[model samples]
Target: MKIYKYKDSVYCDEDLSCEYDNYAGDLYDLYLDLKEDNKCGETTRYYVCDKYTGYDEPEELIEEEFSDLVIGEYESED
Candidate 1:
């Protein structure tokens, strides 16, 4: 399970271990709560999962679900 921390929020992959539908709601709530406390710009966390595979469980799934999210444009291959 890999967590990509973006400038605004985090992005993870939803798999059998991590269901987006279930977590998304709670995550949104947390986002709102955090926004209320922190006066910074609002950002949203997103889960990228396979539409075919109903497995949306753990945060680890993000590695296989979406690799692109981890790779930054300015990051070197080395």
Candidate 2:
């Protein structure tokens, strides 16, 4: 399946190192959700990568769900 990854600085200043992969959904939908939160401040920023990743969930898996948003190559946590 295809999925997207994104990053956001929510409910805090970008310089605070609070940015993380904290949201999941369509870009616009996520943006609106953040906007409604109001804690992210007016300058909160959202970023969507340019390539989509192929994701496969193990049939017996129970951890991590799927997200649909902008496309991007998956980055290693390392």
Candidate 2 wrong stretches, greater than 4 Å: 1-24, 39-78
The residue pairs found clashing in candidate 2 are 11-40, 51-71, 51-72, 52-72
| Highest-scoring model, lDDT | 1
| Per-model TM-score versus the true fold | 0.27, 0.22
Tens-digit lDDT track for model 1 on 1-78? 343433344443322124233232222333343345542222143333223332243332344444444523222235
Residue 24 C-alpha lDDT in model 2 = 42
Question: Per-model C-alpha lDDT, please?
Answer: 0.35, 0.30
Error of 1 at 47 (Å): 8.2
Displacement of residue 74 (Cα, Å) in model 1 is 17
Model 2 / residue 78 / CA error / Å: 26
